[model samples]
Target: MIVKRITNVFFRYALRVITLLFAVSVIGFTLVSLSPVDPVQQYVLSVGSVSPEQRAELEDYWGLNDPPVERFENCLSAILHGDFGTSLLYRRPVIDVIREKFANTFALMLCAWVFSGVIGFILGCVMGANRDRAADKILKRICLLLCSVPTFWLGLLLLLLFSVWLGWFPIGFSSPIGVMNSDVTIWQQIHHLILPALTLSLLSFANVALHTRQKLIDVLESDYVLFAKARGESKRQIMKRHGYRNIIMPALTLQFASFAELFGGSVLAENVFSYPGLGSAVSAAGLNSDVPLLLGITLFSALFVFTGNMIANLLYGAIDPQIKESYANE
Candidate 1:
């Protein structure tokens, strides 16, 4: 029965992924096709005036003269074969360019996620446990204020206060002098990440705290919780074993959605900090009208969102036996 249930889950996940990939491919192709500027023309303009023969040759090389549907089909084929095509601006394979910058973005995202989830969860649990008290009210107000603040503005404020005024860390990308200095160790790398990570974490933390507080409040009000309380279960035991456990699935759902927002949000943060991440790379690609690079970044981001949601669904089953049983029945 467990094997059957797992197989069904895997099948559903695969179907969803395949459908999402197709949808993304269609949307990407459509958007690119509808753009007024021809990539070939843009390339020609960037390269200065070219002879008619040179223009034709460039178009032929890029297969730009091919029918739109044929071009899209070719693109899909290339993507399926793990060939992301070449970037017009960089003159390099899109996959290679993305791979080079992925680590920086991943590191920043991981730090932000950890800080947001851990801190936010703890604060939220405290507030929820306290319920209508002064501490709960204060925490709620703080989270609301944090949510209202713009991420970019907050990032700038942190940059000015910490990096500029205090002289605590380098202001920008992996040290303007490069990462090779003997003084620049792993701890130094983490120190530099502090501002950007904090800036990114603020919004995520607020979201998690708000969601967790709401979910915990709802869970605490449930009949099972009340019954446990009546049975003389200690508050700590009830919260730890029942309340927190039940809230985990909902929290995981919100976290998955946050992953999508983080990619776009990180772009602004990366710009402010001059971080050498995929967000910065995407921004550069957009400015340069590097279609392949832009597509690569977009597709990569889509993949992240898709995979995160899948993991969240699986986690629901693991954390909530009721959810697993319901799925098994289906």
Candidate 2:
């Protein structure tokens, strides 16, 4: 019975993900089609002008003469067969480019995610535990300020302060220029990564911290906590016995749900730092009207975010048996 329930849950989420991908593909393709950028014209500018005959051949080759529905159908068919089509901007297979760019992006986001979660949770705990003390008041003000600052603006400021003024990190890019890829050590990559990751982390952690603080405070005000206080239980003791569990689940939900925001922010962060990741690639694809590349990225991103939400739900069941039983019964 338990196995069957788990299978049902998995199947349900799987179907939802499929439907979401299809919708995203349709919407992305429609938007790209409506974009004013003429991909062929952009390509021509990149490669120098071509004769009218050559231009016509290019259009026929790309199936630009076909109806939008026909073109989308053909593209969908090819994708189902494991072909993502070629990128107009990079002139490489879309899958290949995405693979390379996604690796860089994954590293940057992972660092930011970990840092944000850890720092935010710690700050939230501190603020909640201290209440209206000086420490809490100071951190709350800082979080409020950070919540208002844009990610790109933060990246720029970090760029100027750390890279330009302090000269502690590189100005930009995933690695130092002129150095062969093979010669780039792990430390070199990390050095370049610090500012971008820090920028993203700082931009991301405030919401988590603020949410966690409020949740903790609510837990502190619960009847059970008041009863414990009347029983002469110290604040620290009650927090240890009652606080962590109650607040953690909500904080976990918030943390996991941040995957999409981090992904979106990476685009602005990556572009600001000139990092060669999916964010930069997507930007180029949009600017140049690389339909296949843009659509592929859109579909992939939808799956990515959907997976995060699914994982959060699954974690909830794992961490709480009551939740699992309810799901099983459903």
Task: Report the number of the highest-lDDT candidate.
Answer: 2
How far residue 328's Cα lies from its native spot in candidate 1, in Å, is 4.3
Question: Candidate 2, TM-score vs. the true structure?
Answer: 0.96
Q: lDDT of all the models against the reference?
A: 0.85, 0.91
Quote the positional error of residue 65 for candidate 2 in Å.
Answer: 2.0
Task: Estimate the Cα RMSD of every predicted model relative to the unseen true structure.
Answer: 2.2, 1.3
Q: Where does model 2 exceed 4 Å of error?
A: none
Tens digits of per-residue lDDT, candidate 1, 41-155, equal 7688778989999999988988888999899989899999999988887788998888878888888888999889989888888888899999999999999999999989999
Minimum summed lDDT over a 10-residue window in model 2 is located at 320-329
